[model samples]
Target: MRKIEFVSCHRLPERSFFFRGKQFPFCARCTGIYVGYAIFIPALWFIKIDIYWALLAILPTTIDGLTQAYFNRESNNFLRFTTGILAGYGLAGLSDFIAYWIVHFFKYLFVN
Candidate 1:
């Protein structure tokens, strides 16, 4: 049997969550990101999230990740998870905002 792993994440055991003695497929940060996606994507259709807010949402994760990578700063699972959630939510919102504007522009050009 082939072992499946999430390619995007290192999936370090120390950074991951365990349930029932089995480690979760994704690390804590990734888990939070997916959870954020689950919670935010559905709301996109109803909420009309703004571009500024979306960009703002992503800042924390960017800073956290960068600091960890370049400055040798260490982050805990809780911090990673929280920042991941913000990043995921921001990404989804930003993508939706861009897509909406593109479609609207095309529709306007073709229809009017």
Candidate 2:
């Protein structure tokens, strides 16, 4: 019975929210990205704001992964996952204000 349940659940669709165990809307990196964004965005908004610094911090992950990917040396899951998380967090922090502005702009442009 347990084996049947595990097999059935494992074969379920990724987008479906009907599985067991940990529940995340997206995968691991996505979860990290969203959570990181929520924590860092507000802190950066109220504290010291430096987009350049954030970019600098995130550049290593970007360049390393991209170059490796381009060269077809992308067998390192750990490296890719780490880089993706860092880049996602950095983008979220740097773009929070821009995201808000865009949403507000769209709201006014589309509504009425």
> What 10-residue stretch in candidate 2 is worst by lDDT?
1-10
Q: Which lDDT tens digits does candidate 1 get at residues 4-112? A: 6536888899999889998888888888888889889998988877899999998998898899899999899999899889988998899999999999999999999
What does candidate 2's lDDT look like per residue over 2-109, in tens digits? 233322222223422233774434433344455566667677757653578667657866676477659865434345446556766677656864777799999999
For all candidates in order, the CA lDDT equals 0.89, 0.57
The candidate maximizing lDDT is: 1
The residue pairs that clash in candidate 1, if any, are none
RMSD of each: 1.7, 8.5
For all predicted structures, in order, the TM-scores are 0.89, 0.48
Model 1 per-residue lDDT at 95: 90
